[model samples]
Target: MKRIEPLSAARRGVPRWLRRALGPVLLIALWHLVSITGVLPQEVLAGPSVVLTSAAKLVATGELQQAMWVSLGRALAGLAIGGTIGVSLAVLSGLSRLGEDLIDATVQMLRTVPNVALIPLLIIWLGIGEAPKIALIALGTAFPLYLNVYAGIRNVDASLIEAGRTLNLSRSAMIRHIILPGALPSALVGLRYSLGIAWLALVFGEQINATAGIGYLMANAREFFQTDVIVVCLAVYAFLGLAVDFIVRTLERIFLSWRPAFSGT
Candidate 1:
């Protein structure tokens, strides 16, 4: 008789995307189970069903849609400003010792201070309008990208530089062909990190005496003890983060197609 394989040893037939989705599915199931069983009180944490209902109500009222648009606009604006500053500084500092000496020290010092802590100063400087909020998001995102891109540039293989030298490639050509491509992977990683931080910054930024956004919804919910609404807002933040992350991952797959790396099958 043929020996039977254990279940764990059986070849997996599940699609990769389905497998990836299983984790969230299982967690939601467990959450729903605990919620209905009263393992956690609704006051402490609302059930997924309640949260879903709350989300639906917000959607029907168009409140959620408006808030989402506002939040997305702020996050995108901040990202654009921050990404430009981060990449420009990284390229400058990474390419030349003099530039590094001038900029890196200041960046290193500033990054150690929490971006949120600057809210008071930022409010004083830029006022309670959108300026402070956008500036805060930009501040939070810049450091991660700068660090990664700078490292990527500095870490390009010495042999590649030697090869470029042998080819008599000019400074600009060498950077364009060898250095920048080598740094692309790291820069992509920085982008992913920056995107995550941008959402986080948005969370804090929106809470600053704001009249709109998901954070504003949560803040209002807090005053009324509307746990379900708060939970819905929290879920919105999570979903937004996941959506942006998916976009970045898609970009990576497209840009890094030439780079061979082991897929953890």
Candidate 2:
């Protein structure tokens, strides 16, 4: 006869989404408690309610929407430009020994230097305008995608290459049909990383003579000690990051539907 399982051994009844939400909920509750008790002063950091109100005000005044659009444009432009350069260089370096010898070492050296450290030089070269900001973001985003794409190309299954060889596939056909598909998952991961880096780079870039954008708003708020407004800008940044991450996840699901792995149940 089968034995009954103990209650302690049963799976959780909580929904997956609810379980995920619980942690943030608990944190917010604890924060509210401390805030109401005056353990956390508003001068240092505004409480959640104040931050929410500030966000609403910004939204109503249309300032937040205008700022968001400007920031989004910069981030997307940088991502597009950087992604193209990264993919081209990765393809070159990964495919030919001569290309690797010429390009890889130089890229590796440059990658060692922090992108943020180049801000002053970028400003000197490109000026304290949108040009410098977009260039900085592009520079910051390129390396991650380049590295991942190169690795992915080099790591494509040898057996698959042999199979293509047996089929007498042309070089172009082999790359188009076999190598690119094999490398795509890694490229997607790199894209995700690059997207994150783009946002970070934008934050730094916007701090330099920016007339608009979330970074500008935050900087302006700091002058008046508007902690609530600062927090609102921070939250906007976070929400945008999360939104882009979710988009990437959706792309992975669409493109990698054939690949399967253990889901940590």
TM-scores for all predictions: 0.94, 0.94
> Which pairs of residues clash in candidate 1, taking residues 3 or more apart in a chain or in different chains?
none
- Across 1-265, the per-residue lDDT of candidate 2 in tens digits comes to 9898656446768877898989989998888888889999999888889888898999999999999999989998999999999999999999999999999999999999999899999989999989999998899889999999999999999999999999999999999999999999999999999999999998998999999999999899999999999988887888898899999999999999999955555
What is candidate 1's lDDT per residue for 1-265, written digit by digit as tens? 9999756546667777898999999999999999999998888989999989989999999999999989989998999999999999999999999999999999999999999899999999999999999999999889999999999999999999999999999999999999999999999999999989999999999988898998899899999999999888888888888999999999999989999987654
Pairs clashing within candidate 2:
none
Residue 102 error for model 2, in Å?
0.9
Worst 10 residues of 2 by lDDT: 5-14
